[model samples]
Target: MSVHETPRRPLRVSFEFFPPKTEAMEETLWSSVEKLAPLRPDFVSVTYGAGGSTRERTHRTVARLVSETDLPVAAHLTTVDATRAEVDDVLEEYWQAGVRHIVALRGDPPGGLGEAYAPHPGGYANAAELTAGAKARHDFEVTVGCYPEKHPESPHFEADIEMLKRKVDAGASRAITQFFYDNDVYERYLERVRAAGIDIPIVPGIMPVTNYKSLMRMAGLCGASIPRRVARLFENLDGDPATRQLVAATVAADQCLDLAERGVGEFHFYTLNRAEMAYALCHMLGVRPT
Candidate 1:
């Protein structure tokens, strides 16, 4: 290390996990949780499935986090097919169970990805409306979603920025972006967001790519483009899990390091309910338990 080299900033990170559906998956989820718990991330989030299908399981997992660990847990809530009353009840349930933060979203419809989303007959119409609803019920610290590469459904970038501003106005405290391989995309998005006067913490969502095929599928669905250079790095590692994991950790750590150099200090990892890759990325970024 040279004296002229720049100092790395302290990084604050959070992990996202999903509710387990089966007994073995449940055990796996808890084991992953135990492994990452020691790092004491800023907060941990649990995802809600499309159309809120995993509502009960998400609630159960969050409640257990509250009771079993001294971690700050954020529960994902989505307005998909449920009415406002139903959504309100779920928020109250989380409140009673000691969850304070929420990632409110207008989730994918039950029809699945690429299908047009129509709000429930008596439900909040979009994420901005959902944010308002959550704030009305309780003074929750709400987080909303953002897309660096314009959302697939959005007509243009300007419209996406407008929607984010509306969500902020409706009481959302932060916005987490969809995962993207290009840090420049995020930097440009931040400029646009600030130019539009939406002042909120826009956390970059980092997804460590352990499986190339699965990553491409999600990137397709979310409109994140995989730069050909990155694609070249993972080419032909399909049958070699060890090499694949190494490439994944290195790619993700490089992404985080590049962003950190640009003055971004916070990151939210889409853990896919695994610990090794995310844990390794954090270590590479110099983040450790407090």
Candidate 2:
């Protein structure tokens, strides 16, 4: 069978985490990291807050992971509300902290979530610029984000693909899509990306619905659709934590398995600072502690 038709590629997984703002949250994040470390994800990424708001926190978290764990760490960098020199310094810091991978992004608009994005006058214009800068700084394995449902600001899919092509031209090595529910959306997107001559690994981003309400909010913001069938699964479980957890795991595992059947081997999970769901999903996908 052709590689695309056969599920022969080994399953590979990675995770993304956000920096904590409080001491209690910090403890929880570390605990989650500890539990997930045994699975040996391809890499663990720490996210930069909107407009670099959590710059120091993100740096500290990523540096600690680099020093404390054997897993590869990818530090996220954004071209939001910062000068080129400032971003350069942050890149330098990541390099000094033993980081070799970067998740480069244009980040959210400086005004806030709903505001129109405007690049800082003195900073890199967008992810393409940031990706190029990181490449110039070091031999970093740069990964950029793609949207299967289309970015909220992009005029259309064609324009969105063009922007992604720019990132690829600027030296991005991989692309992890925004969280999406339907494997078909991802499958179609992969076809478009490949047709555009973009040849990087397009990893699917899986978000286990920990809280239905929160998932709705995020989905709205990121342009990910809520399939009626999937939404129906969580319709009446708002107050049941235990049941919600079970449902979330079952649904996410099914999503991954369906993708695997289509020969998708890499997954980047948005952990949301929780380990149980990701750990369970990884186990379901045949990743176990070594």
Candidate 3:
């Protein structure tokens, strides 16, 4: 690392948003969308609700993006609760609405994660199957979920790699990992993926923690470990939203820079219906609107 070395080009970014449940929230959500649209993300995704509750809203948001914005939109589809035919119908609807990209997922069970995962008798069995269905229904650019620390239900790393391979074989063009604080976790998992001969892009997912308590709870439920230092950074900021946001942006910026130094170029942000922190972090990473 020499002082004469030039900085690398800004990395590509994407954002994930959930459909709003109320008028106020809808306004907030669209405001966030408008704020981040100028950054020219590779694509933006709208998440389908648990048990597919927001199916219509998700479709509407993605449809609006297609009709109203210049940014490409990826609709998140899951096969956790619906029959294969039903899920395929949703995929068909998205295609008709002009969605060319999909984030295929098995989705959380109706009972939620850590509970027993019983597949719908007639639905796609897993993300791999969902990816295959999406490809069969339409020529979509599909992205599947990856768990760098191993999905909680997976017996071991080899099993995780095998699952990823299955999805790739089923026509997934890329993988977006669950958010993690440790860059080493992503780097090591990537090495394993490459060693296994899976070469598709694996974009790291980043969740900027504006609320420490909420972040910790989500991380615990999802099997994403929070480093002690990360906890320490927010230990006493419980009452200070302003300072918490500043620290959140700084931490995410550092995480992205570390990944960039290691040659990783793509990031997927879980915006959680807010854009300020993600926008700030992108600014720090040298990303500007095209």
Which candidate number has the best lDDT?
2
Total residue pair clashes for candidate 2: 0
Candidate 2 lDDT score at position 52: 88
Per-model TM-score, in order, reads 0.95, 0.96, 0.95
Candidate 1 structure quality by residue, lDDT tens digits, 1-290: 11111233677888899999999999888998898888888799999987679989999999999999999999999989899999999999999999999999889879777788898999999999999999999989999999999889999999999999999999998899999999888888888888887778889999888779988987898899999999999999999999998888888889988887777878899988888888887887888766
Clash pairs (backbone) in predicted model 2: none
Leading candidate by TM-score: 2
Tens-digit per-residue lDDT, 1-290, candidate 2: 22242344457889999999999999999999999998888999999987789899999999999998888999999999999999999999999999999999999886656678888989999999999999999999999999999999999999999999999999999999999989888888888888898888889999988889988987888789989989999988988999988888889999998888788878889998999889888888888888
Worst 10 residues of 2 by lDDT: 1-10
Error of 1 at 223 (Å): 0.9
Clashing pairs in 1: none
Worst 10 residues of 3 by lDDT: 1-10
Per-residue error (Å), model 2, residue 114? 1.9
lDDT of 1: 0.88
Task: Please give the TM-score that candidate 1 achieves against the real structure.
Answer: 0.95
Candidate 2 lDDT (Cα, 0 to 1) = 0.90
lDDT (Cα) of model 3 = 0.88
